[model samples]
Target: MGRMGRIIISVIVILGLLALGLKGCSTTLRKAVFAKAMPGSYFAEYSRIHPSLYQVSGQVYAFEKEFARSMILRTPDGIAVFDTFDTAHMISLKQTLEQEWPQESVRWIVLSHNHLDHIRGSDVYPKAEVIGHKDINQLVADWPNVNSDIASVTREISDDQTLTFGDVTVEALYMPFSHSSTIYGFHIPSDNVVFAPDMMFVDAVPPFGFPDFYYPGYIRALDRLIAVNAEHYIPSHMDRGTRADLIAFRDMTVEFQGVVEDEYLKIDPEDFIQGIGMGDAIKSAYDRLHPKYGHLHGFDAMFVPKFGRHFGGTYLGY
Candidate 1:
């Protein structure tokens, strides 16, 4: 072989290597673009503003609007609503309902929990029978300033109440200490879907600002929901999920708790919040978990500060 032959071979090898590198870079860019397109990212805010209706299965429909979601089940008798959005959006929701199901009246309004966002619009459905956990009456009674007419007609449901409307059977199970002490989950046997509010946010980490979390009970509730083996799961705030997503969420929660607890143990219990500092502790825990969960939406900008304060406060008994 001559020197010219060797030079040509070297050039070919370099070009081949460059092609492979470009291909790898392109693949990575595509992945990053897809991740941003998914829920919980910046794109979510735009997608959430416009109310969208999705048919889960048969007569069951999921209505999502700007970080809040609700479900509707239609039967020959009437329509049953899982949760009404905030009171301000009640008019739009009502209009959508009327346009979608003109003849059917909303006969039942079921509250997933006592949270104002999920229940404040109950009065919009005047003729509907409002159903909720017995604790909701007290929650409403405590808030006399809020003009909620649903409280007056709200019927208390037992822990294991099953509501049957035609072919649909919705089982409302009491899941205490998960999101709130009074929170409950709705299981639809026909659709094989479970609607659990505020317990899990699909495709995204839980929000940072709201800190009402009972770690132990939240794990137990997730375990129970997973055991149900539903084909589809609907959370209050985000997109629909699957059993795998629930498992992922549970695993993430357990892993995060372990990391935070381990870090918290490093500092003196008396000085955990003050001396070590809440922000520093949170950043430390986040740094350890970032290798695994850094890709999750809100891990950096939203979750770190809120999780730090909440976990630090819990550790310090504040």
Candidate 2:
């Protein structure tokens, strides 16, 4: 071979190898692996907040004042609220709903769970028929200093419980563990929607928490909800949504479940060694997912200790 030609060929081969190595390290590859790890099948549709609703300080973590107060289900009889803002913020949300749907009253108030964010504002809507998981009442009852306004009409809900109010039919599906003992989602069949609180944090990964409870159950509940085929899955906190979001959530749940199961299934010696690194897998997943969903922590905030305890991780390692 000619000297210059051989040199040129060598340069081409080197460049080709470099290109192939870079391809494996590309952000696109990372994203693809992340997607496989999460297995999301749908995209959440994002839009500007509806004019009728606006944010209040207590509605979200103090940092996010832009989060809307509640999801208003407007019907001819009245507006059915998915959840009310914290007690301090409910008066304004009630007033705003009244101003927009002047002829209607707040007919129903569905509590997705017993979380402060879900039930704090129960007092403001005096006439609404309150519905929630059966266990939520116990959460309120256990609180020695429970707000006086929430004491009434705090009905216990069960799985398959159907609530018919005017044109709306709300079906409460019990979603226990993970976040709370009595976590639940309200399905609005007429609208083909489900009001899911905390189950799908959308863009945020949850921090650790107490009860040191069942996360696999959370995945099961999500799977059950998907089996119901609701087109719109709205969260009690964010208060807006679509069916595709739930589908994506389903895919993500499946992926996470697979990771956990796969990690747990390793043979004894490998299991002990790899178990130590599972935390890294969890963190890597979170780090990759965080950029897209970091805003999640911006809302349903949790301390690292609670998260660590909840996930059984020493810290954020897994």
Candidate 3:
């Protein structure tokens, strides 16, 4: 390896050892790799944000609290919420909801998936009926806090279903095994808006390859999302989205998978010494991909780690 590459590896190893476990090592390495890879800022413009409560269409609105975002719609019945984003953001989120549509009551909340971060904070709307996929029926029943009184899933959806409340009709698209089996996308026909988790990042790579990610499942779910043709898409993590944004993310995923597979196939078993070969392979993939996707947010810091994750998963029988 060249001096620059060796220096990069050394910095990552030192940071990894000092600050984090294998996961921390990945996080630490992203910044270092991005710094060395370019002269300009490695972080993408889209990665930066000014969190706020904003409206997308007439009644469809979104509130951003730190990294958590919630999509709210003002309907005839009351106000409908997609996901809470986080329990920690309850105070701020509730305030935003009240301030934006004070007259409207929080009638119901539909969970995009069962991930704790997105599903928490339903207690803020005590009267609101909590809705989730049938997959999480047992999960909701078991959770002490939810089933008791403050919050509980009053209704459950098993497959693709439509809900007409107020003036809008919401279509729930069941997505299994993309990010998780519990994921469901809610589509509003009136506003041409869709809300869900694991759809796609706005203009950046995902922080990592999650343990539950199934390549075939992601592809299938993504294709289904495209067919829905909602002009606006709200991923719980980042609410600002367009059809182009999702398409770009899907393209990136397809390309990333292809490139990683080709690189993995070329890795010589003999080069496993000192972990040199694996590192080089990751670097090679980075070099090839950066020119195309480097402009996206977190590409430098997250690209190699993601590549490592997908490649590593291959080893574990992905």
Candidate 4:
């Protein structure tokens, strides 16, 4: 081979190797996406907020921003908690509840899902009826880390099950898995308030990774929520929002789905690693909503991998 030709060949080989190395570095397993700890910020701010409750009529109270868990107490009956906090947070929440209404007892500890942070405080309400989606029951029964204390009172709730305690009515709706396999979105029909955890997540767009895996279902779940026509919405993570917030979330998910569908139609999955590919609609929606509603700390890390997964799984079901 000629000297010039040999050098050109070597250059191409070097470039190929460099590209492969860069690709390897960006994959999901590389720990490329992670959120930083706020260090007492969430708790401190939450504590100062002084949990506010909105009575949606008929013994139903929407407890706003309280100790990790927001509750709905049915006066003259018992209390039903939406989502409980971590172990320590649960204890604190219980104490706060007692301080506010010492006479009332938490009769039912209903979970949005079996995610650790949400159900960590299950031990607090000893006699309370622990309720969740059937999947949640499976998760606990098959959990790698089972807390015996919390498992005793657990009960699996079917889709569209209604729990009525005196004047209060809490409805559980089954939502497809996004963060965890077993998840449910709760709705209060009387108050037109929906208690959706990660599905209608209030904080951070949720740890979205696989579009084909579970995100499409996430979008569908929102569609169902919109069908509810709930006037008021309570999210698990961030602050309570007006109907506009729910609309925005629904719109964003649609835009996100559109981007995934477009890419799936236009490109080969293998080319996904070439670069970031967001369509005009997706980019516009994300750019507008992210600053105010997005989880800034998590976006930089989680979005790319999530995109990558969505790319690969475009045709393949997750």
Candidate 5:
């Protein structure tokens, strides 16, 4: 190759290495580090058991799979499901759907995001029309394994979109970069229920160091969810909650993030490499936030890692 061509390739290689280096310092990396030190309980990674179905008012029911939750709405034409949670969870969900309403087939599988956790196993309902945000297509190209692609999704919700069939209307509002770049928070106006994936916790603390959460977008998304005035709030990671519970969690998370951000900003950006002021930030955040949020579920468990997320976010400029 020519000298100029070699130079260009070298620059690309250097940039790629730098990107990888930065990613090594990400929340996922930190979580992994902690996991090794404090090895967590072992469980079936793909196995789901003792699935419980709760009637959330009328034809709308919530299927809680171990930890993740999916929603089912029975309509005159067919049933509509929000999120599949992977094959094992989907299989149970499908069984419950068939048992409750034998005649009605699942017509629609509305996904929360393109994340494998939420979008997997749509093939369990092959005939059902799969839908997600316009950004869903990015996974088609980005996911390395062609087999893992969300290939069933044909319908894409680009704007404030709604799917209506037999008195059930599921409105999806795209909240970009809140958690996933293309996650859609679903609101069922008639049912007064909202299915927001990983945005807010009901009474629990933020897990995995707020992984993939873009702070600014996350706050805006929380506000959007609160404004919905949903009587029932179903976060994927938690069971069910009321609008009051959702508001409480939202306020706590916002305040925690704000304090962490302020503490981190106290340090100069250039001196971040040494992390000289990090100890003070941690102390200040703990002192200011612990009194208010300590009683919340999993607060003691997730306190340290969750608070450090903002500093990591700041360093990464997310």
Candidate 6:
């Protein structure tokens, strides 16, 4: 064969290899996108026990109680428990701890927020030092007819702080006005897990309108959580979640917010109430996003009335 013929054969071989490589790359990308879009339901094996315990990582375990969840970290120093539920639930958790790991002592009690449901059982762990955001004290002080002793017990934390015990490090990040002004999230670097209470919901949609939530701040908090890049993301209310779950929730929230804002902008503020009542405005937003998010739990029944209407009103200044 001539020199030119050999060169042409070499070029053809290179082209064939390039096409094969591109085919493999395309297949991998498609699989990744499909997995992200259709994540498996993590709540399929959700525990029903009052205070069920599941190991989330080597030294980290999750204590779940129906809708409320907490984290238990076992370190060389001792054990750190986060967010004790109501009094009765706390008792059950304590009993479980005693039964399973009698040698382990509760050295620290961490609060995700000052919400009553999350902090009511703090008193149960008498020996443990309670930790929470500094604003938690002020929230307790403002409450009427409630015991002020909680403020006295809590050791306030700043915007960002870390508690180290042996090889384990737990970082608490304060996210103001996310769920509430006093909320914070806990990140455990060793376990690659983040405990975010009320910051994001997994396997379910938020009620119609996020009552008492600062919408923009909530989105920011969610963004912050995603940036942590944790392997497992656990929300207080529901099951164990992955990074994909959090991203999905964030995308849905941003989409829903856009729908509400777009609808509100189309209407004049002066005739807002007269043109479309709060309920109708909420319905409009819900209708727009339903096809994309209709599969989420509470999309039709709870989310529209409880969260959507309130969210629309906030945007419309109603």
Q: Write the per-residue lDDT of candidate 6 for residues 103-173, one digit (tens) a residue.
A: 98988888888776677777887888888887776776667576422423457877888877556888888
For residues 158-194, write the lDDT of model 4, one tens digit per residue: 6677877657677777776555666777777776677
Model 6 clashes, total count: 8
| Tens-digit per-residue lDDT, 233-300, candidate 1 | 88777666777888888898778777777777777757753575554666688678877876766655
C-alpha RMSD by candidate, in order: 12.5, 13.0, 6.2, 9.6, 11.3, 17.4
Worst 10 residues of 6 by lDDT: 36-45
Of candidates 5 and 3, the better by lDDT: 5
Give the worst 10-residue stretch by lDDT in candidate 5. 37-46
Model 1 stretches with alpha carbons more than 4 Å out: 1-49, 146-153, 269-274, 277-280, 313-318
Indicate the residue-level lDDT of 249 in model 4: 67
Pitting candidate 2 against candidate 4, the one with the higher lDDT is 4
TM-score against native, each model: 0.78, 0.61, 0.79, 0.70, 0.80, 0.78
For candidate 5, give the lDDT. 0.74
Query: How displaced is residue 93 in candidate 5, in Å?
Result: 1.0
lDDT of 3 at 236: 65
Candidate 2 lDDT by residue in tens digits, 126-187: 77788777777767777767545563445666666777666666677776555577676666
Higher-ranked by TM-score: 1 or 6:
1
lDDT of 3 by residue, 1-318 (tens): 346855775676566545444554476566665455442333244345555778877678877665667888888888877787556566677777678668878888877777666777777888888888876656656676644322556788877888766887788888776777788877787888877576767777776555568776887888888888888877666436787888888899889888887788787767654465676678788888977987776665566568977887666655
TM value for model 4: 0.70
- Residue 267 C-alpha lDDT in model 3: 73
lDDT of 5 by residue, 102-205 (tens): 88798888888877777777788877888887777676567667435245578877767877866888788888768877788888888888887887676677
Candidate 2 ranges with C-alpha deviation above 4 Å: 1-69, 145-149, 209-213, 238-241, 250-318
Local error of candidate 1 at 269, Å? 4.1
Give the clashing residue pairs of candidate 6, or none: 207-303, 207-307, 208-303, 208-307, 208-308, 209-306, 209-307, 209-308
Best by lDDT: 5
Clashes (backbone N, CA, C under 3 Å), per candidate, total: 0, 12, 1, 1, 0, 8
Error of 2 at 86 (Å): 0.5
